[model samples]
Target: MGNNNGRKGPGRREILKSAGAVTATAALMSAVRASFPGGAFAQAAGPETDKVTLGFIALTDAAPLIIAKEKKIFDKYGITGANVAKQASWGTTRDNIVLGSASGGIDGAHILTPLPYLMSLGTVTAENKPTPMYILARLNYQCQGISVSNEFKGLDAKADASPLKEAFAKKKAAGKEVKCAMTFPGGTHDVWIRYWLAAAGIDPDKDVSTIVVPPAQMVANMKVGNMDAFCVGEPWNDQLVHQNIGYTACTTGEVWKDHPEKTLGMRADWVDKNPKAAMAVLMAVMEAQQWCEKMENKAEMANIIGKRQWFNVPPADIIDRIKGDIDYGDGRTVKGSDLLMKFWNGGVSYPYQSHELWFLTENQRWGKLPMDLDTKAIIGKVNREDLWRSAAKNIGAAEADVPKTTSRGKETFFDGKVFDPADPKAYLASLQIKKVA
Candidate 1:
């Protein structure tokens, strides 16, 4: 990881500047201590490791981490210095989390929701060393999309794949295969695309090919005729539409409203060793998330993240989607939608156990995890809701903001499929397209 300026290392001046900043932050925290009651201020402590590095990909949802670093929110929370490093891909993010700080990689990252579980289970690890990871918080929700190339321009396939099945068949018969791409196998994007295809009786595995492509490269791959369609997070999806390479089939929110997407993932060892530091990071990011979810702050957020050091795309490409101004690039436009990326509001930041259960169940459905695995036990071990609650309490979060229970009950998908966390096995059996065995 590089310095905050994206340079190889910090200079002596940078170190001195960081120390002065921390001294100023301490003064500010002291001044605000008299406001909160019940010694809430006593519980908040400086991070064990004030200087730390975090990883992020080139996606809009990575805003909270970037904002926390850019706006000095981390410094205010006793994280004297923080570096937000750019990861090449989600796989690299996973690998870096596994390697951890000891190997000069990341301590944590903005990662896919299911990745922590998979990493904990050693399903997609480098050396099968099942790294114990914890979900600090969910970063954002419902800003991903499934996109198809211009070849499917005239297809009447909005939320239904029946019309596109024939094209896939024809292409196959003609000795050319239709392919779909997702950021990672068994990730949120893959699951969404799989669910969409399966809902219309088209098998993702049998009907067409599914391949892995990094989010940033998705539009380029589609442009070069490498894939027929792709499911990815913005601004790539929006970038594709802008570049006339592809059109939106449907937003992931249309598939599953307010779907959990990226998460703040950290190694369990790091959390245990630096419990106060972990809370500091969480508190700063929580504040940053609230700032990001505000409508007034979105444009500035877009400009900050769209810089060459961050997402490296035009601000306009990133701004429209954050404001819920959507263009499907096929003559369809949505003026505004409540289904845009939500960073803080609507309990979007809560690490719901039910959500993780759904992810585990999907992993099982796709043969990524065994169906007989103890989901409740695994979830309890992986999801640190206790830590989240503690952070919330220390930060003086609103009473309603803290959930009464970890379970969000049940969720209903766009295809009318219901997932009851209590009866995950039954839900698995009911799924028409799955490989539970």
Candidate 2:
């Protein structure tokens, strides 16, 4: 997942039928007035922009883009002509936007968290100049899952749920260390999985080797024993379960409920130049976000995303967790958390400064960014809260939903003690096992 273009085998109609129920529910809810508070869409700002081009990477989290188009949210907001192209990968998504900024083709992108940070700091290609990009709003959260190959049955019975804990025990029994896979280095998937491992007393960098595989390649790598486990977004996790090659180890929701997973990214220059259009796009997507959060729309969204041209899997494969159902395939099946794809729950979707800083701190922890960089200045410049506020306001989002100020909440990862974002020095000092350069 995390915006992959891979496909697995087909699924059963019974699964599809359940999927249909989700679809029907979404369709019904789409027709209902948004029950949430204000009319974010009513008396919308007059037509300021007529055309737009958007990009996505073909994952379930791309639902906001798809639903907005399917439901004509863009048209509703006065943008008549829009292009939503599916990029090959997250890297490509960032590249396209960067190139578009230079060539005047791409406007904004559905991008990963590390993108703006890396780009702002000139960590990527040199040809691409600094394209100002900021967080519009969080698209969705807490849907990524860690899956273990079926061959690793011992993982299911490990004393701790953390894969790193199991990896340590398995290594003690054998001479070899376990292999864990993540999509990218200095990325959210890598950080979340690594934090989970370290919390269980396993050193991610020392106890096991972390490999970089495209989200699409995770299953194949696992099947070939190149990796013992992977943490990725869906429908890849669902694809693994459907293929009978792996079992769900733990969902990201278990680690941090409603954790920020994806966001709507725009070139900072684009936002500054086209503030009205930017706010309109956010409103349209927010409308879709509300639609997807409903129990009913899950199936239709799955069906659409499951097409070969998009996510390219069977609807059944993608429907379970989309509708809040979890299947570990270890004889464990549970309802998916409501926090599964929270578009706007408890100010969850709003980009918090502390949250952005968390990613920055993690980047430094892993040496993606220099250990001595001025992370606070970089984070403050890159995470554009002012832009997010305009878009949320345009959508009539409640003021209460927007936190007046960021909270450096005490956050404990899979590691034993909680972290104080305010005192990152202590937090970094507390780590016994770390990435040594």
Candidate 3:
């Protein structure tokens, strides 16, 4: 009885409606919420279930989920023994989340922030039937890189990618296709590289081929001269520079300062089925984000995630840029830069509805989504900021520390483009290099 997508269809409600099991389930969740008013479910009050399988790619931003499991914070919050499985790629992660753990896949994941929305709308799924996903928290801000091959080393594109337009033009005129790789279609990396190229007057869709490459494969693909430029999360980008294969043009944060990246996303049905357990898992991951954001934790964090069982990367590849030290690999170096990744810098991990709007708008500009799509209604269905708020208070976050508003006000990008969440259509109309006319 599987659906056209990875998940099974005609759920428990359909099969058990006459048995009253669904009613009992709802009653249990209501009772649990009443007992734990702050949303902090611990061992004493207990959870409906003690385990769920979560997935993550080998990116540094997946640290919160791994740290929670490694440090037994999940155990502390009554989500004891939750599995943090490693995903081979973003596409696999999507399929698995749809499949759910009971069906031999995953329950949730450290996913691209835009992906949950796309999946929820069924835009990227096989039959275009919504998966009903939920974005619980933004995992990190910044630290993704747009890197160029050493062939363009002299160009040194820097923050403005205009320098590479001529080189790309020459490549195209030579009767060869120019390729730019990103981790997933309509995901953060795709949007970033597209924005970078379009800002320089290069058409990402028409001027160059946008290919899908997993984050882990980006370095090897570049080493073999498979792509001219790529956008991805660390520690792969740092590894590229270490191998002398490429130099980073700019960290994504430079393009749009404090930009949202990965997210802790899960199937909405899972949250509904296990409300208390979901809150417990959210609280544990939030606590881990706080620990991961500390300056002193950088070395240890790098060492832990670098182990073969995890990212299998070298700590040296991860530690440098993680602590704000950068070696651009083209004779430019920065010490203690502000462009380092932020795990829980104040409300950095809060899932702002405003940030999600920009992602949808960017996807619209590129034709991945319909221009007339109901962005606000979709955001309302997919973003569970209310759940995030509950977890924050229960996790002992000071009231002052919690964000009062869902919007981060207006966001401005490097090329002087501004995205006011209040006027996404205006932002879309202002873009010169877009698929939308």
Error of 2 at 209 (Å): 2.9
lDDT of 3 at 264: 95
Task: Report the C-alpha lDDT of model 2 over 188-300, residue by residue, as the tens digit.
Answer: 78987787777676777877788777777777788777887788888788788877888887778777756677778877777666555666677777778877877777788
Q: Determine the C-alpha RMSD for candidate 3 after optimal superposition of all C-alphas.
A: 10.0
TM per model? 0.90, 0.82, 0.91
Candidate 3 deviant stretches above 4 angstroms: 1-44
Residue 60 of model 3 has an lDDT of: 96
In terms of lDDT, model 2 sits at: 0.71
Alpha-carbon lDDT, every model:
0.86, 0.71, 0.89
Cα lDDT of model 1 by residue, 374-413, tens digit = 8888888889887777667666677767778888898998
Best by lDDT: 3
Q: Tell me the lDDT of model 3 at 202.
A: 95
Candidate 1 vs 3: which has more lDDT: 3
